[model samples]
Target: MPDLDPPKRSRWTLWLVLLVCAAPVVASYFSFYVLDLRGRAYGDLIQPTRDLPASLALTDLKGAPVAAVSLHGQWLLTYVPDRACDEGCERMLFMQRQLREMLGKDRDRLDKLVLVPDDVNLTPAQIDALTAHGAPATVLRAPRAAIEGWLMAAPGHRMGEHLFLVDPMGRWMLRTPATPEPSAVKKDLERLMRANAGWDKPGR
Candidate 1:
């Protein structure tokens, strides 16, 4: 019988390659989670981080399908609000845009997202306003239940009240209070950008 040694060696090699590719992400997360981040991080860290759900269905205003996994590769600063673009929702969108802009050169490393729940549609004017700023946010419609399942709100608080942060690896990790101060949130964004600077890069 022919020797099977070469095939087994090739299999082991493949496993090694995968492990090597995953090392940087694993190491960075370990450092962030295991280290003394409690006193350092501004946003509340999610204990046992949640991965973005595969079932998260998203669609553009035109009704085109968007893969949930496609959302990976860039840090996401996300907000979920009702279909109506009320004064409060507009205020949050403004703040979210400001937060991303404040990142300076690192701005591209993060993307702003607004998840509209209940499959409701946005009016033409609302879409225009959302896309007005030079750096427009990616607004997509998602199921209300799906958003609730993936992101948790504080006790007695609605999910829309808090802003969420998802890492490049697709992990929903950090969250801010309902009325988040831009300055304070900016600090947290800076800290996160600094921490993952090594492995994370700009763009999706």
Candidate 2:
């Protein structure tokens, strides 16, 4: 007669493999939902989470139709700048870039989306500034009406005053400070990446 059950060592090995495989998913959920993230992080969790609408018309830097996947496939740190990239606006833009870069090896999992009103175009100087910073030449633009309806701001703050944290599902989840310390923002992002490491990877 042959033994039907596996040996004890084999059973333990199987359990170990299962745990290793599931570690990422468990850690990710714990990092996001169960942890006391607010005490030490920069994210402001959005109540009644707002997801970006696919029907909303979007245009890319090339004046080409924007793909729906671009908005939702990766973790996004977004900002809305006025028509003119003033000194303050540039500073914010710089911060956004620097913060993403601070992610180091995990940087690819994050993206920068600058939302601009449809009625405005970037001046040559504005383009040059963004270019000098190695920013995408043709940034994405969305209708002002849509931005107002879709994104929420903190009390007494307008759309242009804060950075948005959108989840990979395209849901708007967090509202960051208008002017955040790069190191502080990096910490927040690192926590998020750690929490989601099991499920999230670099790239869309």
> Judged by lDDT, which candidate is best?
1
lDDT of 1: 0.84
Model 2: runs farther than 4 Å from truth? 1-27, 128-138
lDDT of candidates 1 onward, in order: 0.84, 0.76
Candidate 2 residue lDDT tens string, 1-204: 665466876988889999997787667756675684756667677766788888777887667789656677788888887556677777887788888888888888888888787876667777666556653422687788887787876887666667888888888877887566678777878888888877887766
Q: Give the clash count for model 1.
A: 0
Q: Which ten residues in a row have the lowest lDDT in candidate 1?
A: 33-42
- The list of candidate 1 runs beyond 4 A from truth reads 1-4, 119-121
Q: List the residue pairs that clash in candidate 2.
A: 24-198, 28-195, 61-138
Superposed by TM-score, candidate 1 places the C-alpha of residue 71 at a distance from the truth, in angstroms, of 0.7
Give the Å shift of residue 80 in candidate 2. 0.6
Per-residue lDDT for 28-144 in model 1, tens only?
777776663667776789988899998898888777989999999999999988557677777888888888989999999999988998655667787897888788889888889
Residue 123 accuracy (lDDT) in model 1: 72
TM-score of each: 0.90, 0.79
Give the root-mean-square deviation of each candidate in angstroms.
2.5, 6.2
